[model samples]
Target: MTIRDTVIRTLAHTNWRLALPALVLTCGSLIVQAASEDPEVVVPTASPTTAAINPAGVVTPAPGTAADAASGVVKAPIAAVAPPTAPQAPAPVDEPLMKLPVNARHMLVIDDTGRVLMAKDADTVVPIASLTKLMTAMVVLDAGQDMNEEIRIEDADVDRLKHSRSRVRVGATMTREAALELALISSENRAASALARHFPGGLAAYEAAVAAKIRALGLTHTSLADPTGLSPANTSTAAEVARIAAAAARYPAIARISSDKSSAVEINGRPRELRNTNHLVGAKGWDIRLSKTGYTEEAGRCLAMRMKSGGQTITVILLDADGSAQRLRDAAAIRKSLAKIAAA
Candidate 1:
């Protein structure tokens, strides 16, 4: 069957939850095969692209978006969905997109007054990488389990889907709070996995809550398949990502943990220093309140930060930057430029 027809049949015939991996596999295989046959086609990576997956865990691309070319979902880009009008907060005073470094698929800068200083592709949906953990942390907190409760990492927490390795071992145990701290501070996939595994009913339940929270928060474009963001299906737009950064900053622990430069933690009875994934957090003259960085061959490099500069606070989001260094450079440039602008 064709990718589109297979997807249609998967939706109509089987339990969608179980069919996602198959869908991702088939679609990715087909796309790669086609790309190899066409010499002119330049696929970024031979592995199936993350955009090859979606909320349903299926490889069908949401038409017209970046993922379309990857997953073979050929169609016009979907128009922006206008949400029901509500009491409008004053829009942030608009500013122009200043000179920015390349490799950014989407970028947004929103200031304290709700002014959008600069934005590009803010509405474009894309894979968010481990930024999904911010919501995972929130959901874990919402469950109201004792942060001090003890939990152990297991084989299941290992990234079987991606086969990504982890510093936290299969049998090591720690307080739920520690796992959470590691998740936010270091973007540890195993830490995130363990946190979800320890959730009331476990990872499946945690994932369900994540989906619910996305809908509840009116994050219309965000979709999460797993807590660790190992699943390429974990996706969101730059606009929704900024909103998530704001909400995540509201949690004292999230704000504190994410902004901490580094912390010492014990895993497998050995002391290890867990450092913030976003280097801008500790860079001189930069005041980051909450930050998270994520990267995968599929999603590229991503960053979300609530930065405080002078008297103004802004959420700066960069998604799918070409490399780690480029994303940081883009952020630092933004801060310096904005600070100069505000001073003037």
Candidate 2:
């Protein structure tokens, strides 16, 4: 082809590339506008199957799926909405290249390379306290249950394990989305119980689901008895806690909400402020992506955090700490020591 012809073709190709995104954006805007209009148009949302959920909260199969042909999922009277389960990353390989001592009885720090940078009694099984909520969030999100489903706090969720008090009082109402947020962000025992209670087969089924998930994730040394870590039975090793933290950070919902400095939700028709259990989330220069704090007489003050700062990602697990302040100090010391090792 002649140079002039080739140049013209190149320009046309460039124009197509430039215009395609603009065209898509314009069409997307129009569709959004249509959806946003008063008496909003009913747009059938697509899922893994050809099924669609109606605005009136009914599940109907789209035109030609097998479900439509059989009218199976449609006439069931109840819809099964499962969360898309994201596969877990394989367990990290142990690299005992460096050892750093900390106050905690069990501690672990894993880097993005899946290397155990530092560890102390990481395999000792101990009660994880609220860190169990990390697994709870994972199990719930893996179920892909309707996030908008309303969950009412009941006396059943009154933390029979530890009798912990929650800012979200019983008899208050909120969505599963908010419940999950409250569970992970604030480590609310009631929210955790409510999530398990509202699971397909109730708390028992939720426990089974969590167990199945643990098996699936290959957590041989980690198993939880309840949704909340209040029970001493909710136990795991520091190594496994690191793995759980890694898995939690992978989910956008868990990663996003767990790291939030603060969240606001309507409880009993009044705005309630929920603070993150991990105070490191709000500290300057500490790019924590996921955090959970737990404390019980058995679990002591425990902390699990996934930090992404200065382009480095590391998971910190501290269990059975003496006090909350001491746990924070250990974390800071660990980070400092890790930084020095990395610099060397």
Residue 207 CA displacement from its true place in model 1, Å = 2.1
Candidate models: Cα lDDT each: 0.76, 0.74
Every model's TM-score: 0.72, 0.70
CA lDDT of 201 in candidate 1? 92
Best by lDDT: 1
Candidate 1: C-alpha lDDT: 0.76
Over 137-241, each residue of candidate 1 has an lDDT whose tens digit, in order, gives: 999998999988878888888888888868787889888888998899888898898898888997778878888877766677888888888788898887788
Q: After superposition, how far is residue 215 of candidate 1 from its true place, in Å?
A: 1.7
Q: Which model scores highest in TM-score?
A: 1
Poorest stretch of ten by lDDT in candidate 2: 68-77
Q: What is the lDDT of residue 141 in candidate 2?
A: 87
RMSD of each: 18.7, 23.3
